[model samples]
Target: MHVVQAALVAFGVVFVAELGDKTQLLALGFGARHSLRRVALGLTLGYGAAGLIAVVVGAVLGAAFPQRPIEIVGGLVFIAFAVLSLRRDDDEEDDDHSGLSVGRLAMSSVIASIALTILIAEMGDKTQIATAALAARSNPVGTWIGATLGEVSSGMVGAAAGSVVGDRIPPSVLRWLSAALFALFGVSMLLGFP
Candidate 1:
């Protein structure tokens, strides 16, 4: 029951947070060049690896610190994430490919290239940090599963639909929605509501 609940919460938080993120834009770019299946696979693998690391670290931190303090800190972190989410400039060009030549990669290298790109991008990313915070307050296994799925789902959507989805839904709308969810989570944590 705890695992299921944690998974649901983590999924909602991460999925909302990752919408319109740079990695999703990367997915759009990559999917344009590579097979959608390959992109989805790469996204799953990359997010899974990152999610595992985050949950492990979060679990360790949760074990080390008192629950109340961890909750307070996690709440603060979520609030900070909310503010940061709103501050991001949506109009910035997303042509930066992290110097990876997407066109030159061989068929076999596509998955690896995409996976490596996603892994690199996820380092210190808001979604990763949020996953860690959620894991600290919930079940690590569930959090990892949910976070990985959430990230991969968003990326898959990007890969499948291209920029159409982004174009259809204004970035400001996603940003506001994500910010609201983060703020809600933060407030809930601060209030000691599980």
Candidate 2:
């Protein structure tokens, strides 16, 4: 089915986008202090909620606009984001969460803290934007499911191997890969490829 295919494509794109991203890094840091299960659950729930909102927004936009124009705009947005990612400095990528004081909140309950943290962190994130864009281009439900799962998967991996993976792999490589994938999809959309 087309839905299945769309889900798979969304999954791959979101998975690649999440790797070495700030969300994953946050998961890794949280996992170090809190229980892995808690971190995973928090991330899953947070991302799920975020994905749902993104899908709804995208679906609304998709319904309002013609397919070709929507696709063209989505493609352009992806391309623009790709360029932004390519130009982003490594140090500048670190999200400054110092003022938030998640640590104090974590003292009460790790799960709640993590959930809140992820919900806040994920707001306006690149992965969220990508999910919204994917929804606009494909099946909204499928895109939401795939993107949420992709985020959860990345969270799990980061929880388990954050230190190792983050240290071993350079962030630049992930940025480049994400940029390339976004560019490819953007070009495909512009070319009117299904």
Candidate 3:
């Protein structure tokens, strides 16, 4: 029961945290010009590193902080992110694959850049906070594992349907749905819902 609950929180938080945002767009834009497989690999590895770091941090913080504060902070942050998402405008150019390849710098550069961005962005982000709270609910190992699994697999969830076409996943209803989920989760956490 605890594991199931942890998984739900993990999946819900990570899956919603990554939506029709800049990073996802960058990955898709890279996929548009390069081999989707390499792009996918880069994204997966980059996100894996970020998720691992987040889980570790969360585990540590959970051991140190009270649950109520963490939950409130996480919920507020998530709501802010959702509102920000509602106000965002996408108009960036694709520079993620300007000089990479299916063999050399492609995978390395992309992975490095993505991991860096996610690390910086996730430093104190709501998703990380929520993940920490979720981590707090379980043992450290389980928390880390659950968070890693949830956050890492989120990319695939966002890009699943269109990924079948050997192209990047389009920001379809998936993005909206993920955003909605996040907002809802945030409110639930704020309200201390079980």
Would you list the C-alpha lDDT of every candidate in the order shown? 0.72, 0.68, 0.53
Q: What are the TM-scores, per candidate, against the unseen true structure?
A: 0.59, 0.57, 0.49
A best-first ranking of the candidates according to their lDDT comes to 1, 2, 3
Model 2 has an lDDT value of 0.68
Q: Model 3, 52-149: lDDT tens per residue?
A: 66656755655677777756875776576556434322321223544544434535654554455344345445556666676656654555555556
**Candidate 1's residue-wise lDDT over 82-121, tens digit each?**
6865765422332344244543344336577568667755
Candidate 2 error regions (>4 Å):
58-108, 162-194
What is candidate 1's TM-score against the reference?
A: 0.59
Candidate 2 lDDT by residue in tens digits, 38-136:
677788888888788777774464456676775576567657755754764432222243245564343335566566556645555678778888887
